[model samples]
Structures are given as C-alpha cells and as structure tokens.
Target: MDKRILVELTTEIVSAHASVNEMSREELLDEIQDVFRKLNALVGVEG
Candidate 1:
C-alpha cells in the first residue's frame, strides 16, 4: 500500500469529522488508526 494513499485517506477522514477539534492527541491518533484499520480490512490490505 502506498503511504500517500493512507495519509490522504486519513486526512479526509479527519477533515470530515468536526468532533476531532474536541479530541485529545491520543484520541485523534486512535481515531485515525481505526479508520486505517477499517479501510485496510475493506480493501483486503495488511496493515
């Protein structure tokens, strides 16, 4: 998997979720990781 795609997708997810502004740094990282995990599962890509 390309790193750019992951970054782009994560960025889009973060940008689309307004609640991120209220999250702590750890929470935001968890949210981003969750999104990547789900996306990878859907696309049959290993982490």
Candidate 2:
C-alpha cells in the first residue's frame, strides 16, 4: 500500500471515531472492524 493512502485512511478513521456521539459499545466495535477490513484491503490482504 502507498504511504499516502495509509495516512489518509488513518486520518479518516480517526475523524469518523471522533465524530461519533452516543454510540453503543457494539456499534463502535463494528465500526472499528469495518475500518480494519478497509485498511487490510488497501494493503492487499486476502479476506
């Protein structure tokens, strides 16, 4: 993966988490998992 793409993805993830309000634990966990999956894909990791 490109360094720029990784940096952008990390920034987006941080922004998304910071923007959330009043979310349940499960919902937050799911969002984190989704972000991880996206990052993995960006790095060419097989599912």
lDDT against the true structure, per candidate, is 0.75, 0.67
Best by lDDT: 1
TM-score, candidate 1, is: 0.66
- Backbone clash count for every predicted candidate, in the order shown: 0, 0
lDDT of each residue in 1-47, candidate 1, tens digit only:
76568768877988678454788788888888888878776665434
lDDT of 2 at 27: 73
Candidate 1 lDDT at 25 equals 80
Candidate 2, residue 38: CA error in Å?
0.6
Clashing pairs for model 1 are: none
